[model samples]
Target chain A: MKKVRTKQVIPLFMAGFAVVFGWVGVFKLGFWNPDQGPAPGFFPSIMAVVMFLTSILAFIQSFKEDGTVKYEKQELLVIASGAGIILSTFIIGLVGSCFLYIILWLKVFEKASWKDTLIILAVVAFIVIGVFGLWLGIQFPLGLMEYIL
Target chain B: MQNLQLLLHGFQTALTFQNVGAALIGAVLGLIVGAMPGIGSLAGVALLLPLTYKFNPTTAIIMLGALYYSNMYGGSFSAILLNIPGDSPAIMTALDGYPMASKKKRPGQALLTADLSSFIGGSIGICILTFTGPALANLGLKFGPSEMTALLLIAMTSISWLVGENPTKGVVITMFGIILASIGMDTLSGVPRYDFGNMYLLGGIPFTPYIIGAVGFSQVIKLIMERDQGKGGAATDMKLTIRGSMITKHDFRRLLPPALRSGFLGTFIGVLPGAGATTGSFMGYAVQKKMKSEEELGTGAIEGIASCEAANNAAAAGAFAPLLALGIPGSGTGAVLLGGLMMWGLNPGPLLFTNEPDFTWGLIASLFLSNILTLAIAVCVIPFLLKILSVPVKYMIPCITVVCVVGSYSSSYSMYGVLIMFLSGIAGYLLDKNDYPTAPMLLSFVLAPLLESNMRKAFIISGGSLDIFFTRPITCVLMVVFFGVVATPVVKSMMKNKTAGKASK
Candidate 1:
């Protein structure tokens, strides 16, 4: 059996999506309308066919390459932190979640001293809250805190 | 004369107190970001894009435009001082700049050469854009749906050049971008597309946050993964004062010729679809290699530094023409600016020249202002910019991440934008690791909607017949060229095989 490397997975995933697009485009969405114009799915159908063919070509070409991608521990930790911040935003709001995420990453991963970490934290908070919120007037996600208040 | 009057009017608009302040802030921020080793202009613009949301359309664009133009000047600072290039366009600058600095012991002069040539080249590019912009827009006004579709097709094919080593991979990424863009509601019919039953999907992915996440947040991930990669080179102990940076008359004469030549060449290249400043610099350097130089090319030569540095700055200026005239972004940074135009409630096609002359002319005028401001500021702040290089990557990663989060959230005032940002950041990182270029994806995302709209319009005009693409004279020529571009590599490979078979026999 032939083995696909991690690099090949990107194309395969694209191919998988292409199949779904093509399927839905033809049966559910419709490709051509009675107005002799394109329906909602017309463009998607064209893209689906092209993407499917190109992804297969990419898959075939990936066999010429060597080595699977190795994910480092640091990358995973960073991604986890990103996910944590994102999930926490639903509860604590953007400003709060970012405050927690940044503080933890600096203290734990970077091993920064409290002095430096706090300074960085203070600057970051001022920029996010003072500059972005107060200065620009962008309304951020209130999360569960809005209801609680 | 007509363009000149319009340009003077534009300068009047750009010289306003608020606009001038915006331009100044953009210039300083641009230099800071451009001097930083890993962050390119794409990310820099994306990070700061949120700041301009509150400003008026003209003011906002002038800020972004100045930021984008000054970025080219900033890229050369690190390239000359250290061996590392701040951006891809500066890669050629580093070839001669580093040796000129360290080996020739003229670190100050090397930077000054880059600044001077950048100034000259950028002036030429801005001049060309001022005249060409309205003419191009006038020409574009003649393009019907069929002609527009063909022109966009040619533009779309340019993505193949950015695909890196794998053409197939480029196609995959381009298609993926189109698919992503198609996820929102269908504009014509008001029907939802590829939304997966999510409410946010109906609104589509936010462009600014997507850009910030893909370009900025992904860099943060890379910094974390390779903690030791951001090390600064030995840059201390050099007399970096403006007086110490002056070049001799003979050296200036040598630099002037190459800078002038590359200025014209780079501007034309920048106007081409997807070529941008990186290719402009490379081609400029390549041409200079055949010409006579005062010193051997690439080993501390003034000509070598001038050629690429000038070309890149010119190309950055030239990219605005297509963006303003055709509503087509000539580079990734231009795509971000195009997205900004959409967000600002302005249409950016052929009508832009007639409809919004102040906005168009003001942006063009600001480039000239930025060219001067950047040169003076770049020369004065070399000592300050060098300090930014020493700030540890660990510190940079967190600050940049917070900015990315906040910027994403601000784009649409929701968590949905942030979620898309994180997801695309992962996708961007993966693409970067595997040698798949992210630029083509972003460009495709911006172009797909326009292309789809035009093509559908052409079909509507043609009554569902395919001849609409081939029947019109201008469309015929563009389509023919598009086919030729697509077929050349395939034909060349076939010829190579035939020759190989004959040789084996």
Candidate 2:
């Protein structure tokens, strides 16, 4: 498989953004309203058009430069860790998810000693649950805990 | 006399035990946070803002303001000791400061110079704020919608041009921010524009979560990616001895002039919307370097550290001038503070003085104490802070990520906010990687609503005519400045090309 060029990514992203913003501006929010001084969609629709034009210019400019993505194992692991943390938040709630993430990230990704992992887990849990949860009285989704309690 | 009386009154409010305690805590935490990599004062302030929700406006502002200024002080510590600038503003400090610490073996002198310069610059900046803030606020009161729109336009353009090498990317990112800001119901009309189908869209995307994700979480990801790299070895064998003999009388005399000059220059730059501490510090360093022979600079010259440190601290204070007076944030951190002020149910601008004198004055007064406290705490805690730097990158990454997740969740008490934060983090990372300046986007996001609302107001008043922006004297001047800011670089590039053509011929 051919790797995507880094220089091309931005122009592509910009083009995609323009399409979405333009579609939303015209279809979802009407282009204009005569009764109102300026319609709700006026600014957004203008922005969409500007973005579309600028992105074309950027695309043309990008063709002159050549730079490709260099995928590395460490970078892939970091990306996976970010995704894992986000997915875990919905599954176990913030406090619980943080605990799971810290353990997995330390033991699996970083390959730290189990003792170090456990110490980190304990300290993180204490702060999240004790300081934020109990003291601040901030609420969070208790995915598994909700069913158990 | 009037200013003095107001300042004394401000001190009275700030001197309360609770306020004093909050200031101290804020200073210490700000120092620690600023000393850490991947989280500067802007992220530090944004992450901690939710915790200030319960406090009164005065106490909250005092704490945040103290945190904001002391963060500047803390940034220099890591810059000097480890050549790793904890924040952009401290980058200049690292150039000369690291050399002083490592090669000259005068780390203590370098730290002391930075601390003293910061304190002196900050104190002068506060004095400037006290006298100028109200007068500027009075002037701001005269500005109507037209003037406001023009001013905001100038600010957006200037920031976009000045911040990064790629002006086109900056402008595009800024437009994106404005588009994001226009997501909720239109302020003038009751009609919802970009809700798509969700009920949550009506209330608009919350600022806190987006900021936390963009500034805080994105940094966490970057740090995690680089976790395997060894920490800079500069701080290992550092020994600090704080004595008068460290910086001789001759050194002090030589440093004082540059420090004083840079302090004023930084303060002036800070008052301008979109110009920040980083710009001020760089400009100060450039001017100081230009004055001396090339050999004197980048060689641990005391003047180099003094000028940069003074300017950056003064710029932090100068940033408050526009914020307090015109409700326009002068820097990215100022933008965050503006959001916090709005959250606290206080409208910034001229009316804030009349509406919440105690809050305004208390914040100003706290600045004085925060700087002094920062100096004392930084000097005493040098050993402890150095220890913090030794903590492995892997440990810091996970801890910060958890904090970001929890902080985002706590802000709105909604899963949606967390999702937005995570997505914003990804967006921020991509944007940063692509060299699209995030500060312009953040600034535009903060200012978009104001600009749109005022533009609409001007149109309504002028019966849908665009002439209002050009008719009013102040508005006309602002519009001209806006055009000047946008055109200057284009003209300069054209001239450069022409010069090269001539030389080739």
Candidate 3:
């Protein structure tokens, strides 16, 4: 079996995404109606078709290219951190999640001192809560704190 | 004379303490953001866009406009002192600016020349815009849906062609953007199209988060990916002093002519859709080089610095002309400004002059004042800017990410917006990694609804006939130009292939 290439992955993914999107637009969204001019799905269906065709062209173009998926350890860490952010956002509130994210990013990724991480986290939390919450009056969603508070 | 009176009234509004302060803060912020690598004026404006939510329309426009033009001045700093350009427009400046600073040992002089030339260019651009804006708006008032559709088509096609490496990719991305835009409740039909059974997406993926994620967060990711590559390091060793006689009499004499010429040239280029500061700077630099000897052209010639800097600044000012007068954005930044205008509930076309003369003229007047403020603030903040460059990228990354989250959330006061931003950032990163240009996607996304609505109106008026586009003189001309822009590259590539085939034979 031939190994998959990074160049091929994107186009293949794009093609798959386009097909699904097109299917949804056609079957679910209702692509056309005789009484009305163009329906809402008309534009999207056209886009889906165009995207599908382009993805195929892109795939064909990628076949001649010589490259492979090359993910380093650092890249994996970055991806993990990105996931950590989303998970934390759901687990904690916006401000709390941001606080946790800063601490972890600083301590783990940046390898900063505990003292510095704590200090920076305090400042970031103050600014985020102060400016956005107090000043702008934005009502951020509460997560775990919702029950406690 | 009446224009002059209106400008004075504009000055009265702009010179208020609050407005002046906003402009000052905007200029300072723009300068810092522009000097930072991986963040250009687009992201700078996008990052700060949420802050404008509380301000009045005039103040918001004033601050955003100040940020946009002052960014041009800031971009030249890194281009000169270091070989790295702070923004795309600054790329040409780096060609000669770095050479001048390093070889001539007059970094201050190089910076001063850039600043002065930028001022000259900006002043010229504002003067032209002030006079031509109303006149152009009058002409634009004559435009119907057919003409508007034609103009929008031209704007979309031009941006798609000029912005990216591959025009095909640009068009595809633009189409995707239009699809994304069509996801919300269709205003005419009163039907939600592609919300995917999700309540959060009902408003159609709030634009602020989408843009912030795409431009800002993706930039952070790109920076992280390149962190080990030793990019974004400080130029601490290079001393950028401002105390001495920066621009000597001799240097001024040599720089004046090219600066003035490029100022006009840049302004003209800026007025054209999709012809931005990058094009203006390169064209101005090329023209100056063609006029001079080889010795004077590339190797730290003051003329080289003057032409590029002046042209880019002028182009920055010139870009506002179309946006203000015709509601057609001339560049990516201008498109963002157009979005801001819509957000403020102010229509940006001809009626804007009559309906809100204060906002229109105040913005124009503020441009002139901002140039002067930029010069004063940029020179004073050189030391501070140099120090900022020394701050480690690691510390900045988390902070910027936090800002992106807060900024996106602040726009609509929703966590879903922040999530949208994160998702958009991932999508942006994936697309960007594949060599797709996001600016065209962004421009098209902003224009998509406007284009669709106008096209619909045009067809309805014409009783569902496409021939309406050809029947109108302005629309006919615009359609021809649109096709010409699209066809030129294809024809050129075909000719190149033919020549290559003959060579092979």
Q: Which candidate is the best by TM-score?
A: 2
**Comparing 2 and 3 by DockQ, which wins?**
2
Residues A57-143 of candidate 3: C-alpha lDDT, one tens digit per residue: 878876665555454455446545656766776668777778888987999778989987887777677657775566445677677
Give the Cα error of residue B65 in candidate 1, in Å.
8.0
lDDT of each: 0.80, 0.75, 0.75
Task: For residues B1-505, write the lDDT of model 2, one tens digit per residue.
Answer: 7877878999999999999999999999888766654357887788778999999988998999999999999888867865545566776787688788656756777788888888878887888888888664345356678887886676455554334566567667777777888887888777886787788888788776676667667766666665665342334355433442157887788778888889888887667555578767766776685476323766888888988899999989988877987788866788889999999888898787767878888899999999999989977775554453455777767876776677667766787777777788878776776666665666567667867788778887887788998889989998998788678769999999999999999
Q: Model 1 chain B, poorest ten-residue lDDT window?
A: B231-240
The model with the greater TM-score, 1 or 2, is 2
lDDT of 3 at B485: 66
TM-score of 1: 0.71
TM-score of chain B of each: 0.63, 0.64, 0.62
- Model 3's alpha-carbon lDDT is 0.75
Candidate 3 residue-wise lDDT at B419? 78
Error of 1 at B344 (Å): 17
Give the DockQ (2 decimals) of all models. 0.54, 0.45, 0.39
Q: How far in Å is the alpha carbon of A77 misplaced in model 2?
A: 2.7
What would the per-residue lDDT of candidate 3 be over residues B1-505, giving only the tens digit for each residue? 8889999999999999989998998898888767654356887787677899899999998999999999999888867764445676776677677667656656677788888999998898899888887564345345677877776676566554324456556666776777777778876667776777887777887776777677667766766765653323443345545664267888898889888999998887677666578767765775675465334655788898899899999988888877888898877788888999999999988788889999999999999999999999877766554443344567767776776777677665677777787888877776776766675565567666767767766766776678999988988997898788668769999999999999999
Model 1, backbone clash pairs (residues 3+ apart or across chains), number? 0
- lDDT tens readout by residue for model 2, A68-148: 544445544555666776677666766777888888888877899999899878778876777667754667788767887
